[model samples]
Target chain A: MHEFSLCEGIIDAITAQTCQQGFSRVRRVWLEIGALANVELDALRFAFEVVREDTIAASAELDIITLPGRAWCLNCAQTIAVGELYDPCPLCGGYQWRLTGGNEMRIKELEVE
Target chain B: MCATCGCGETEPVIHPHDHAPDHAHPHQHDHAHDTRRISLEQDILAKNAGFAASNRRLFVEQGVLALNLVSSPGSGKTALLSRTVQILRDEFPVAVIGGDQQTANDAERIIAAGAPAVQINTGKGCHLDAHGIGHALERLALPKGGVLFIENVGNLVCPADFDLGEAAKVVILSVTEGEDKPLKYPNMFAAAKLMLLNKTDLLPHVEFDVDRCLDYARRVNRELDILQLSARTGEGMEPWLEWLRRGRHDALIQQINQLEADLAAARSRLIHGGGAIRRTVI
Candidate 1:
């Protein structure tokens, strides 16, 4: 799964930060993943456990913060919460809408010693 | 007090601190081992984005129209690419980079179609990242002022996240598949600029609803351009070829404009008598 690849990226970022910040070990990692980011949280957690072995974050706990999907409805002229990309606008039942949020995958912070 | 050996002595020891600190020592260290929270707030895909930016620059400089073809397995991506190459090879240079989990059969097929092709075996990777494409570019000569097709691994989910510095992502859907595929895999359809409805020859044999499929795709991505074609029968290929030709032309024109702007900037520097005139070779 691509979650493994994403985990590799996360580990790379952590290792690079550790080198610069001079941290000996990572105790926890915080991630901000959007609902529409197409990432399975369970899969990501499993991949993180596998990818963090022997690294700075070997025993680090993963903390994920999920963001809700939001979009701007063109017809309704209002911001609406969308669960999926193909979903119609709830108010107008129209397909014309622009996604405004809930597509981000970022490393928010890390607890290190 | 002897904190290192824990000798249970109340008086301070006069020994040098040359020995390693034992686990029992709590406060004998020079620095505090306090845990600190650092705010990074960085995108996880930043590394891949950097590579993709460089690849984009290279494509612009060389005026190469790079298109990433993404789809599910058995969507006839290889067949469509081979046929497209055969038709466009004579007009302009055409090259392909095929990605698969295993064999190089797709690359061989493309080569047989009379164009240079490179096959990237991703092994366990479900998608091709920009870093892999950068390495592949080194192995294959770029088709300057022409089309470079990056046939991504036949996957709909993961490939939607990785950017390979393509001009646009083209998603292929066959009639044999469900009409609600876009609704199921919205991320892939949403990321694509164009969607090709392939295997139209089997539409009559199969109970596929073309209108309903298009509607579902549009709901996912309103701006997605749709085209119906069958790679096997060579039907509705002209329109796809025309789209490619237009894209290549636009890329070349943009390159020319950039070069002209550079030349104008150099002229202004020369007139102003600026120090150290830097000539940018194309």
Candidate 2:
């Protein structure tokens, strides 16, 4: 699954930060994943458990902050909440909207010792 | 105990009464082990994005029309590429980079069809990232002013997340599959710019609704271009080929515009007598 790949990236980023910050271990990791990012939360947690072994984040707790999907509806001229990429504007039932938020996968903060 | 050097000393002696209240300890002591929170706010895919940006720069400099073809297993992506290569090779330079988990059969097929091809065997990776594509580009010469088709690993989910710096992503769907595939895999459909309804020759044999499939695809991505074609029977291939030709023409125009801009900048530098004469070799 792509969640595994994303986990690898997470570990890599953590390892690099460890080197720069001179931290021996990561106690917790906080991530910001968007609703429209196409990532399954359960799968990501499972992948993180499998990928964190013997690394700096071996005993780290993963904290995922899910961001809601938001888009600018061209027809309604307002920002609307969307659940998926193919979702239509709820107000106008139009497909002419541009995604303004969500679809992001970022490492926000870390608890290190 | 000193875990760092393994000195086997179980404890360290600290004399707090010998030091003043304002004195700082020079060695380890029994103090609170504080855990610090570091705010990073970094993108997880930043490394891959960097590589993809470089690949995009290389393609634009060479005027290559790179298309990433993604689909599910047994979607006849290789067959379509073989046919497309055979037809397009006569007009301009064409190359392919095929990604599979185990075999090089797709690359061999494209080579046999009269175009250079390279096969990337991603043993455990579900999709080809931009880093792998950069390494593959080093092994194969870019087809300037032509087409470089990157046949991504036959996966509908993972490939939608990785961008290989292609001009467009073309998803191939054969009629043998379900018509509701677009709705089932909305992310892949939404990411793709075009969808090729391949294996049309089997449409009559299979109970596939072409209109229904198109409608579903539109519901997912309203701007996605669709084409019905069969690589085996050579039906509806002309329109697909024409689309590729148009893309190549646009890439060539972009290259010309970039060159003209660079020339104008150099001419202005010369007119202003800025620094020594520097000749740019293209």
Candidate 3:
């Protein structure tokens, strides 16, 4: 699955950070998942566990925070609550939208000791 | 300002009266009227991008030419790739990195076409990634001066955004598919460097308009080369095969130059930092 590739990226990111910080162990990992990123949180956690067995993050706790998907309706010129990639504005029902915020998936920070 | 209606000019504020706090002197959750901002600046895919860049560099250093083939199901991608391998195998060493949802059918077909083939089962994944291709390269047993063709899963929409470090990306649309495909799936056309309008043999009976299709492809990607050919009848295949041969030849030369450069860099680095490194993967 492409999930594995994405997992590989996560592993690489964690490993790179650990190496840079000169940390030998990682106890906890903080991750922010975007609702519109098309990534499954459980699958990501599972992949982390599977790939971390021989790495520094083997026993790391993956703390995931989900950000809701939102969009800025072009017609209304205001942000709206939306759930999908193609969403119509509640105010004007316009298809054209400039995604303003809430779609973010990143390793916000790490906890290592 | 309110994000939804822009009616609430001031941000919402909540105090201790909004919730009853536990009498515990210190609490994890504290009700406050202060507003805060979360500043997220790092990309989630930052790490993936690093590895991808390294893989691209490796390909460049090895003088390896790569291609990603994307098309819809039943568009004859595998068949066309098979023909591509057959036609060019004797001319030069070629290999294939075949991607599919769950079957070894395409790999088997590619191997039968008389070249090395590696199958990547994406499970439920819809597209192929650079890391997947990197892993496949380990088992592909490809040789120097080799051109690896990646046959992506049959979909036009999802695969365009992911870059597999391909030197060239080709979009194959058969005559059976309507001409509007270019306009409908402009992303694929925009990403690809070559467009193969395959199954030209059926043009006589099919409603596909080649002129309109070419025009649409040009409209989307003005620089993309449009090749119309029927791999079955061998009609219009000469130019296609020739183009493939020339491109691969140039790619091989480029790879040789890269390997030479890498070798030189390793030699100089060894003088400064002594270490043993493997030269040939084969």
lDDT of the candidates, in the order given: 0.90, 0.87, 0.73
Per-residue lDDT over B147-265 for candidate 1, one digit per residue giving the tens place of the 0 to 100 score: 99999999999999999889999999999999999999999999999999999999879999999999999999999999999999999999999999999999999889878988999
Interface RMSD of each: 6.9, 6.8, 11.7
Q: Which scores higher on DockQ, 2 or 3?
A: 2
Ranking by lDDT: 1, 2, 3
> Judged by lDDT relative to the true structure, which candidate is superior, 1 or 3?
1
Across B1-282, the per-residue lDDT of candidate 2 in tens digits comes to 343222234221222233343434222335545578999999988767877888887888889999999999999999999999998999999999999999999999999999999999999888998978887886899999899999999999899989889989999999999998998898899899999999999988999999999988987788899999999999999999999999999988888888889899988878787444443431
Predicted complex 1: DockQ:
0.57
List DockQ for all candidates.
0.57, 0.52, 0.11
**Candidates 2 and 3, the one with greater lDDT:** 2
Q: Give the candidate number with the greatest lDDT.
A: 1
In order, what fnat does every candidate score?
Answer: 0.82, 0.71, 0.23
**Which scores better on DockQ, 1 or 3?**
1
Cα lDDT tens digits for candidate 3, B11-120: 22212223454444333325432222223345666754554676666666655677889999889888888887888888777888899889899999999999889899
Candidate 3 lDDT by residue in tens digits, A66-106? 88878766678788887655455678866566555555767
> Which 10 consecutive positions of candidate 3 chain A have the poorest summed lDDT?
A16-25
Q: Give the per-residue lDDT digits (tens) of candidate 1, residues A5-111.
A: 89988988888775456567899999999999989999999999998987879999999999999999999999999999988899999989999999999999999
Binned by DockQ into CAPRI classes (incorrect, acceptable, medium, high), candidate 3 is incorrect
Estimate, for each residue in A23-80, the C-alpha lDDT of model 2 and write its tens digit: 6679999999998887899999999999998788999999999999999888899999
Per-chain TM-score (chain B), model 1 = 0.85
